[model samples]
Target: MKRERGHFSGSVAVIGGHDHVHALRRLCEEYPDIKWQAVVLPPDSTPCLFLHEDQSMPEGSFRIQNDINENTPTKVDIIGGPFSGIIYAVEELISQGGSDKARMALPSETLEDTPGLTYRTFWTWDHSTNWELSQIGQQEIGVFNPYGKPPGGFLRDYKRCVDFCSKNRIAAIVIYGFLRDSHGGVEAAKELCSYAKERGVRILPGIAIGSYGGVYWEGDNQYNLATWLRKNPQAAATLEKGVGFQICDLAFPLNFPRSDYTLSACPSAPETMAWMEEGVSWLCETFEIGGINIEAGDYGVCGCSRCVARRANEKEAARRRDVHGDYWSHTDMADNFPRLFNAARKARPDTWIYSEIQWDNLLDPVSLEAQRRLPVGGIYQHTTNRTYWKRISAELTKSYVEELPMQPNVLRCQFACQWNGDERTERYALNAPVFAEMAQLSYRTGMKGLTIWGEPSPWYATVELSYLAFARFSWDPSLQYEEFMSRDVAPLFGGMEAAEKFVIAANEIDANQRLPLERLEALQRVCLEHRTSGEVGRRWLSLEEIISRRIYMGE
Candidate 1:
């Protein structure tokens, strides 16, 4: 990997992979005194932490480890806090294609056995955020049920959320797009989809679409097609299920024996076009989903044989039908997405198709052109860093405006801060006022709606604050983020100072603390650790209220 200029000084060295070179650059520039050992590893086999005895630090000022585990030569860093943090951050940068090392390199479709990994914020630790936010009461501040469960297994929780939304007039709840767990099978997912539809909620089913980091396919969706045909005579599997490496998901996080097999398709593969027709038929009849959300397509270019041929024969395929690189440039996994999806629409006639394209794609040649060829209805993570919330808000609104002809429905997505495994969390602000920033950005950008990654099911004070914050923005976009947060937090803690201080302290924790467990412990310590003088400790401040005070201090 090319090192960013001015990253490491003449002092200590920082060794990481090509992808992290950017982050190292930021860290190095941010902390210039620390010289990076600069051990840039290949895409595969990155040592999580690079400080070893044999490896030398720049300037020799920093002491290195004296002894080495020569026998084991263990390169893995399994410390809980750092491990999970690294997992989350690295995942955000890369997709998990059934392997911990998926991002280590581009995966081969013709693997001995396909690998797959599931990513979701199904459960998080933030118990105090929920408790404290609950303690605040609705009389003084507004709260909302930002997210709800989708069409399947989490029914009880989903209903609770829907009722809350209905009562609060919450604009729209995000229904599930996909689920893969041992507890529920296809029958369960089908049921889940049914329930969401009966309730008239919009379902957000995600398709791997065109990313190298996600589940693409060589079109082997025969399972779905078979199910559709067995149940309904009218459905037909248009194309032969392409030869594929199947994804075997582990039943348990600990026991990853790969019990569940799923087929991922490549957009450029011939099988992809055939698979879509099969997928659409099943979806239209079974789930009756409103639309599909194409997610996280930043996998870069594909060197798959077909893509190579297409790149070489771009001039040749220029005259061929359904062979446009821009439309099918994701490699020969049959990337005729626009064409395939169009076929599905023709088959079903009403299902809406939405694709996610990011600003990052704007910089990548493969996605930049491919995404441009296929106009998207929705945009996730458009311009996250540096852009003003209001500026992005306007831009978001405009995104819808620009794509209205091709994509009628438009919504913006923001992940509310997630659990560090504590209700009262110091782990980090899981989801902060960024929701408001997003709302403002959405409205300003010309978005027709908003998608918040949240739920009413309690986790922590931060989660509660997050939902409340989301509601405030959803209810009124014109409201200033800081002001709304301030107002709600004050009453939650019975004092503006407490709420404001907590927010300041929360930001500090988010900036400094990264380990999930450590962050949680620190957050709990700050929240539960009370003032020693008699009166403060004696007062019955609920954990939720206490967390609220810590998180929203002065807001």
Candidate 2:
């Protein structure tokens, strides 16, 4: 690792807004003559991707020009987690100025002179039930009521999810319930819990907190927690008293208004910590809630007082933005959980805690190798399978498990969901074997159990596939990531090869192994590519797409 960093001039230009360009830029400045650019390479060199990134191509890296020489790497097919990271770097690295349509449209130069690591990540988020992959934001089907509208829904839709979990061998089913806008649903929670218990799905029910839409509600905020508690009186009274342990999901809606959420709960700040402590105390002791999750991880918008107070402890903390920035972060909310837990523990003891990691600590390679042992009793890293951008690399989701910590008790392989982004598509988001591998890691990490996200069983075949895949993996991490994809898929989709291939291609595109991307791209260009092909491959792809409505940008 040191060699790689040193060889890359010991300057890593992290792009894609990971934290911000400042931190990376400072690193570049610290190391003289070390150039940094957005162009990144694979963890190890693979001929297929190497060919794609070949600089001899007329338009290289930034943007590929169609007019370029045919042999000149026409396209640098990206396959992995760092596409977003790399692109952000490239956008910043290039001398800012307008150029020819060709140049402007596509950065037509090699970043040879710019020597540093540029990492970006791209993947699909299957937000569908067993029916189809839907859309994001308002376009998403279950955005408002995924678990269902209760009585009828809790029984029907949730059962669909439970069935999927059983069928898939999902490690655990995570239903992030709690509408911040609505009175946090107790009746709904009770019913949902009842349904899960009946179906026998290992579940961890938590709240999206600031999410439903992740944002600081001024109307809600205006009440100044104290005021709100005063208004509510009951909920507030619950806070003044602290508990033993409390769990805070870094704040839901990582993408902010896009995810329709914001506001980070800093556990380190005095007031913030105190306030958070109150919430933790009330929830942990009163609500008897200690174990929880933060699928997206910690409260990263540290510009606030608590974060600033904690800043002095961190050597690099000074570099983070002082102004409020995006509310998303790979932050370990467990760090703050301690302060809150201390406050709570002061109130009560014997509290178990949990937090979820989103995107596997953003390629730190630490969590991938070993997890930081925080007060967080368990860390539910979201290994949700969404293989949307496999053209860059396949089996990327499985990368979450390898570097797991040796824990006493943790539900390490808490597989979130299977439906990648709303609906299922040819794009293989959650490869079965990835979950299997994660399950292995979880088992090894002394994980307590597994949990799949809510609402798995639905109309989509992908959901069925997800449930089946999860089931297989949770029990056997040794299972091959692509094991039985064809045979397995065939039986699910009325025994069609085209459908199997479509699914295979989706995973393969990102698997970035064995197959060439151009060939992969040609494999399932889109729903149309399969619309007429007689091969079972084309037909299956079309059927799944028709059900999902998702389009693959490239192989």
Query: What is the C-alpha local distance difference test score of each model?
Result: 0.37, 0.36
TM-score of each: 0.48, 0.46
In the range 180-200, model 2's lDDT, one tens digit per residue, is 223224444445444443332
Per-residue CA lDDT of candidate 1, range 1-555, in tens? Answer: 432111112343334433244334434444445443456551232223342221222111112111123342213221111112222222222222223221222222211110011011111111111222223321111111112223232444444554343223232343332433321435555664555443323344545443221221112234332232334333221212221211112111211122112212344455544555555456556665555554423222344555555555443234222332222223232235565466546655545454444322222223333344554432322322222333444433464455533333334432232212223322235355766665555556555445555434434445456666665565457877667856765656556776665566555555542335444456556656542334233221333254444445432
Provide the lowest-lDDT 10-residue window in model 1.
Answer: 111-120
Backbone clashes counted, model 2: 91
Model 2: residues with Cα > 4 Å off, grouped in runs: 1-156, 166-168, 179-184, 207-255, 258-261, 264-291, 294-300, 313-335, 339-352, 357-373, 380-430, 433-458, 480-555
Evaluated at residue 346, the lDDT of candidate 2 is: 61
